[model samples]
Target: MEIAGTLRTAREMGLVACTSCTRVWPAGTERCGRCGHRLHTRAPLALQRVWAWWLVGVIAYVPANLYPMLSTRTLVASQEATIIGGAVDLARHGNWGIALVILTASVAIPLGKFLAIAMLALGVRHGSALTGSRRQQLYQVVEYIGRWSMIDVFVVAILASLVQLGAVASVSPGPASLFFALSVIFTMLSAQSFDSRLIWDAEREGRRA
Candidate 1:
């Protein structure tokens, strides 16, 4: 009954897990043998760093949406297209499927990452309706899918590189390309800064309260 009366976390049990190598070690071990990353039960000042990066991500994302993502120069004239504008043009040209893909990758994924990171950060501070396991799963999903958000950047790069014809026609990345890349980078850093142990800690605290 005593054993069943309470649960213990990895930290409470004197275990620390390595983030890089996923190796488990007894607490107080200085580094992981497999990966050499310093062992700690939870990341120090996790929320502060998460918020800082998140703020950067949000700021960069604003410009990513407002500015032109790509510019095209032809024998006739020059044209610039924002992310939404590019998608709309694609749709107008009867490429609805590709437009939808672009919209989902560029807009939906970035916003989803921001919301998921914010929710995880907030959930640690205040209890959430989502179970700890569920939120952890969300965190993993956000982390895994983060790199794909750069699809728009890749598209722009490919177009710019392939379309250059030395006065005939050319495509070039716009200012938004840099901002979009930065937004994705910062958001990914924000997500990585989070300490997943805090999710279970919150759950335990809620149970106790």
Candidate 2:
């Protein structure tokens, strides 16, 4: 039995939830009987894994922006376009909607994910102005949107596949395409490495203090 308006977490009630199967068990349980996965009140080395993957993503993103994402060769001339430059060219060619989508998915969303994950990681470590529920929601959003970070890569791939006209005009993915893809992949790994339960633990500790 529990009281109304005074919610209690499973950890507070001497229970641990399996990270894999989401089954609840007593706190001292070493492994989940249902799934046979090792159980813990919180993920081990969660912050370290998050930061490591985040740093790699940031490193990859630099060259991804500086180098050319797409190389176009035509009988007349050759042109190379970076992520932003490609979007700008598209906009200049009156494809405003597509340009906007590319910018949002490639630039804005990835940057937001980096910042959000860093904030959540730091918040659990030191302290945060946001409430636990808010932090939880932020984490959920970061995880949910991570998969879409590859939109830029997919766009480049599609263009490369479609724009082959026997040397008259051919578009191909450049070096930045690989870096951009790695950035997206590492960013997703960073988001996945985060243990959202830490947010609740931090809140509990705050309440006790």
Candidate 3:
């Protein structure tokens, strides 16, 4: 059975299996509510369509770092903090816990997710058999952890709203907010664009006689 454009195969009959019930069903069935899956004969957009979004996310990640993410004003003095600066400020204030949180959520996680997606995209594009399962595992990790990267964004928004003062102090989001948001959004799109079925397909092809 097929759902979301993926095909499932039956072990015994060696034919496409119903995604919902695990029973063998003839092709072109409109619905299979038993297993709650759809049957589709054709594969979705080929691998390239998936890779394109990954490529865009990789490109956007660069600028997301170079720009300042937040601006602060206190006593008529203004300062801006890039992603690294925010982490440094937390460290300076002896807020090690928040510092580490910011570092992992903003820096390490985003980079890791991007690299993982890039590796997955590259492996699929070149049909690389080198540790396909590992690549797939990396893809799953990226997809699952993608939402955590929003922690920094939420922190920024919350602080900006809470620290507003007529003249004594204020906080505002900066250009990096847009870039950082785009970074998260595109990376998520990158993860979603990947086809996990390709990993299984490659594995099955390897075992085929």
Candidate 4:
């Protein structure tokens, strides 16, 4: 836990940061003068919040995949399409690019996010074989790509708005849209709740006792 050389971290330099405003303050300063927020070097319950939101995301993701994602109404009849069904429909219509995008954003992305978040949480708990830089890049990737998962929702909204024709046909979002949106939101929150600083701490201090 001792730095043998001259290198030092903020903790070693005897500094603390305001969790709310992100303003650096002397370690002993009572509160952030600008924001009036209590200052701490780190979030008090980072991992707990991460896990809680992760579970919510996982639960929401189940229904999101299971239920219909889009509903269509025509003079003939009504049709409901789940995510996979929608993608397959797109592919059948020769819109393979759109179908591929939908699958990647809705299905592949959420699964990738779940795995990535799980790895990040577990990496710090169990000593990571990955270099800090590699792990940091992975974290950055996971954080950056999360917003793209809403492509399915956006597409449905756009179609619902643009394809409304009286007695001809109509498209609307279905039950799964809400759940998918919730899942993406919860996963984003879970990713934000993680403390990237802990990634380095494990390298310096070794695994938790």
Query: Which sequence of candidate numbers ranks them by TM-score, best first?
Result: 2, 1, 4, 3
Candidate 3 residue-wise lDDT, 1-209, digit = tens: 33633444443233455644756556656566567576543235635655677667667777767888889999958999999898899899999998898889988998888677766766765666567678777777888999888878888899889999869999998888777877788778767756676676666666674
The 0-to-1 C-alpha lDDT of every candidate, in the order given, reads 0.93, 0.92, 0.74, 0.88
Error of 4 at 134 (Å): 1.0
**What are the per-residue Cα lDDT tens digits for candidate 1 across 1-209?**
46623667667777888888878898988899998998878888999999999999999999999999999999999999999999999999999999999999999999999999999999999779999999999999999999999888999999999999989999999999999999999999999899888998988888889
* Superposition-based RMSD of candidate 2 using all C-alpha atoms, in angstroms: 2.1
Model 3, residue 151: distance off in Å is 1.5
The true-versus-predicted C-alpha distance at residue 188 of model 4, in Å, is 0.7
Model 1 TM-score, 2 decimals: 0.91
- Residues forming the 10-long window of minimal summed lDDT in candidate 1: 1-10
TM-scores of the candidates in the order shown: 0.91, 0.92, 0.78, 0.89
User: In candidate 2, where is summed lDDT lowest over 10 consecutive residues?
Assistant: 1-10
- The C-alpha local distance difference test score for the whole of candidate 4 amounts to 0.88
